[model samples]
Target chain A: MRILVAMSGGVDSSVVAGLLAEQGHEVVGATLQLYDHGAAAAKRGACCAGQDIHDARDVADRLGIPHYVLDREQVFRREVIGDFADTYARGETPVPCIRCNQTVKFRDLVALARDLGCAALATGHYARRVEGPDGAELHRAADPARDQSYFLAATTRDQLAFARFPLGDMPDKAAVRAVALRLGLAVAEKPDSQDICFVPEGRYDSLVARLRPGAVAAGDVVHADGRVLGAHGGIARYTVGQGRGLGAASWDGQERLYVAGVDAARRRVVVAPRGSLETGTATVGEVNWLIDPPSEPLRCAVKLRAREAPRAATVAWDAAAGLARVALDAPGIVAPGQACVLYDGDRVIGGGFLRAPGSVDRVPAAA
Target chain B: MPVLGLDANATEPLRPEARDAVLRALDQPGNPSSVHAEGRAARRLLEEARAAVATAFGAKPQDIVFTAGGTEANALAVRGLAPGRRVLLGATEHPAVLRAAPATAETIPVLPDGTADLAALEALLGAGGPALVCLMAANNETGVLHPVAEAAALCRRHGALLHVDAVQAAGRVPLALAGADSIALSGHKMGGPKGAGALLLRPGIDLAPLIAGGGQERGRRGGTEPLPAIAGMAAAALAARPEAAIRLAALRDAIEVGVAAAAPEARFPGRAAPRLPNTTSILLPGVAAETQVIALDLAGVRVSAGAACSSGKVAASHVLAAMGLGAEAGAAIRVSLPWNAAEDAPERFVAAWSAMRDRLSRRAA
Candidate 1:
């Protein structure tokens, strides 16, 4: 069957194409041109998409498969980039890679793949799509360290059915790159993209300021107990758990203060002791259940962010209010706008965006 | 899947005559600038090519200045102008002319059908000091013919200079360059190899060198010419038949007829306007040209969208926008039938395009 591989001019995707082609599948490559490269290339710390398009095309050519560079700047800006800024403006930490994976990489590419008459859309994502008795099942990649299932929590069940991740079984990134080198791919030694793909300079605050003006509005640094500690340049610069960059509120009475909450409309960064930052429960919205909702409260492990282990939790889905109430066994900093992904062993159960600190009040009495 | 090439405007496949000329010329040695016996042989080949291209465009051999490509030819004509001469460019002119002209140069608008608004040109000329009017003989996107002769007549009345970019029109249409002071021609556009193009000036016209290297092409353009490419271009020019342009019109129309019927909402922009017989710009609503190009390419039918940048991303065509196609600008894709486009070419393209359209529509529904 013909497969449309989303080759991002990187080694992992390049190796996926090589492996698929070696398996005798008709593999076609596509790279999305998400932004203007001319100005992008001129920037001091550019996350070079310009060179990637060329590399992807060269890899496709070497593999004797046709490659296309699709312009998705308009769509990408609206769906991924715009959402990224809005999430920050609301005083929530956002995983831009999650948003990109959910929207641009999976949702859009899957549609494009179908339109091009391809049977499946393959990606470089490190997550497995297991064919289960119930159509398809999403699972954590075999390599625990490289598991990206946290970022792919929002992937709909239908999307998973049509998507393939050949690299999901690879033991490590080095093994993938070795396959690429063995396949004679040019990007075999290309460095893994480290920072936010769009935020090349790692200046997250500046980007948020530009996209959602006034997101970086100057505000006060206050304690959780209503004590005005000092002044802060912007609440957007402070995430729920960050301890540094609070200026005068970096410490309170010889105790280091961590960011407890960010109130955007109130224009304040609430700082306090590390103990105050812990949350016993998190309210998540826009829940995407990969499995059917559990009838009784389901006991599971949940991850609140990438690079963190899933903590034991009890998650109750209130379908009427379109929200989920998660109670962690041990308190952790449940940052608003961070993803709350429910896991059952190695399988993704469901996920949703963490609700803001104040939003817990809006939860219906039905829950 | 059998692959079919349909993107003639981007470039046509090299003609056999051009291929043979290039191979035969490659055997000869010596720069045209040299004074040796081999040098004279190279010079003769160079001048013969110059005369052939000049005659093809109805100009003297001395008027033709060889440059790199259509872009350089345009840059050479538009840049280094006599001081204080106001440069007025057509809004829909190719970027080669659009960017080459001065940043402060004024623009003349175009009609809805993608034709150069001659009335606007006359007004701009009438309102100005001695001006240089830059317009294409045919649009690269829609292939709509500009009113070059009429615009030139207005320029004559205003005592202005008229420069025509005949990159698309040189071989496809009759060379009625009488009123224009200079014209640009691209070899690749006419089935010749790239890296060779010429800017034809009237007998008395001359400009400062864009490249000041060892004096070549009478110092108008410097750099030793690529002999083989120049020969290929000359051979292509000699082999191009005016009748083929007329024949391709039916094929072009057949494509329009089939595509329009299959997808009624698809706007065939320049269909009614006088355009190159081999071109069609169709706007299929709800589908971006980038998607259409990719879909068709995957189906083994090749075409292109608006002038792609170095990175192959299809930006909304300024030409379509200038013509007031508003929302449909991004929807337009150029499907230019090659010189050797077969009778079944249109059917194959329309079939692939329509199937892709139907699938997308179904998915949307």
Candidate 2:
């Protein structure tokens, strides 16, 4: 079978290509030249940018298969970058990568594979596509330490149909590296890519500044009591549940306050105690189901953020409204516009966007 | 019908004689730089090939310095000339030249027609000083010939040595050693094997050797000569005929017309300027070059984006960036053919291109 492997110049993708090639499949390795607008792309250690392409090409040569680098910068700018800027402008924290996977990387790449006359498009993502009695399903990888199912929740059905994850069944990062080493792949010892592909140093503010200079407004940081704490350099720099670098002037005897809200209209950071961070009920929009919608309020595990552990929750689906109402047993920092992925064990059930508090009419009797 | 490859700019298949020459050279036992009789025989072969390449490009045999390929040849040219000297480079030179040179290097922009800005080159030259001025005889992506003679004249006036990376222009266009102080060429671009290239320096020019080893190429470049590849390169260069370019140009024109008919929005860069007869950089807006290349490949046709060196990465070419082609660069695809492409090559290319357009249009809609 002819498989088109997506090599992102990261250890995982490089190893995936090597493993697949060793298995005797006709593998054509390809790397997507996503966005180069960020200065970090030129930096030495940055992955999936300038240097990564060369590295990917080198690996492809080593694998002895035809390799190609596809330029998807324009599509990336439209799907990922534009959406990122607009989301920030609208006071919502957006996962640019999720949008990239759904619109640019997976969808565009699978289409490219079809154009190349390949049977399937494979990536190094640590998530599984399993064929079960029910049908095709997305699942967490065997490696709990490196499971990336959370980041892949929004992948559409069409995109997932022709996708394969070779590293999905690997034991862990160590095992993957071992396989690479055993095969004499150069990237066996390469460190895992951690930073945002385009932003190696994690300075999102500078990137946002470059895109929309001075868009981050300097504003008042107010305490939960509505008293002016101090002046903030920008509201765009702050996120819900953040405590560090508040730049607050006064706090005589209170615990370090977290950012409870971002009032973009007035350009202010609403601060409060950690106790105020929890929200038992979250209304989610843009719902996508990997499994059939439950006939009743289904008891499931809901993860509100990437690293957060799944908490027991009762999920009620409103098909007509295209929303899911998640009632968590324990209150957590459920922010607006963040992805809320519902999982059953390692299987991803579905996901949706968490609506901001007060925007949607909450069921008064339920709370 | 034999495949009419219009993608020589990407890479030309090795000529049969060149392939035989490589195989013959590989059978020899001794290294050319060694002292034994077998080594002397190998050394003889090396010198003879070097002389052949020099004669083909109108230079002294001593001037031809072989390297791994055109990319390395380019790197040597850009980096060897007056280290620490402020470098001035043409906008459309390959990335190997741009990346190896200093970031502070002044860029001499190219006109929209792919001609080098001689005035800009002169301005940089006048500002002068221990400086290395780099330009290409022709643009790799656009096959548009640059004003090498005019620019070389400016370099001579300003007392700055000129380094012309003539990798794409050497055989297709007439080359004279007098135009530029130094020139770079790739054997593969002229139907030789990959991994063979030469840097031709003027007789009196002094350059810092990039690789130091047992004195070879007059101690300017190091490592045992890739005798097989060099012999093949020399053989390929000698076989190049004047009529090749004329024939290639006609085929290129036919292909361009066919493409334009299928996609009216398609653009040919440097169409009106003097260009390599075989190369065309076409821009199909609202469609990616990679997409079209892949589509063509699926239909038993092959083409490439400009600069096969950076083909795998999907970023817009730095050449295009230097030309100030922001979005248009993304839409550009290059097609190049050898003089030997089949008679039916253009028609087949047109059919493949039509199919690609239909597929892309449907995908877009």
> CA lDDT, every prediction?
0.87, 0.79
Query: What is candidate 2's TM-score for chain B alone?
Result: 0.94
User: What lDDT tens digits, residue by residue, belong to model 1 across residues B1-365?
Assistant: 78889899999789899999899889989899999999999999999999899777788898889998999999998985634799999999999998888788999999888888888887888886999989899998999999888888898899999899999987887877799888999998888999899999988987998998987989888899999999999889988887898789999989999998998888888877899998899899877788888888888888888888766677788988998988888887899999999889989989999999999899889
- TM-score of every candidate's chain A: 0.95, 0.91
List each model's interface RMSD: 2.1, 3.4
- How far residue A182's Cα lies from its native spot in candidate 2, in Å, is 12
- Per-candidate DockQ vs. reference: 0.58, 0.34
Name every residue pair that clashes in candidate 2.
A69-B312, A70-B314, A71-B314, B6-B336, B6-B337, B7-B336, B8-B336
True contacts kept of each: 0.59, 0.62
- iRMS value of model 1? 2.1
Tell me the fnat of candidate 1.
0.59
Please state the error at residue B74 of candidate 2 in Å: 3.7
Cα RMSD for predicted model 1? 2.5
Task: Give per-residue CA lDDT, model 2, range A247-323, as digits (tens).
Answer: 65334266768888878778787888888877889888777788777779999899998888899999999876677
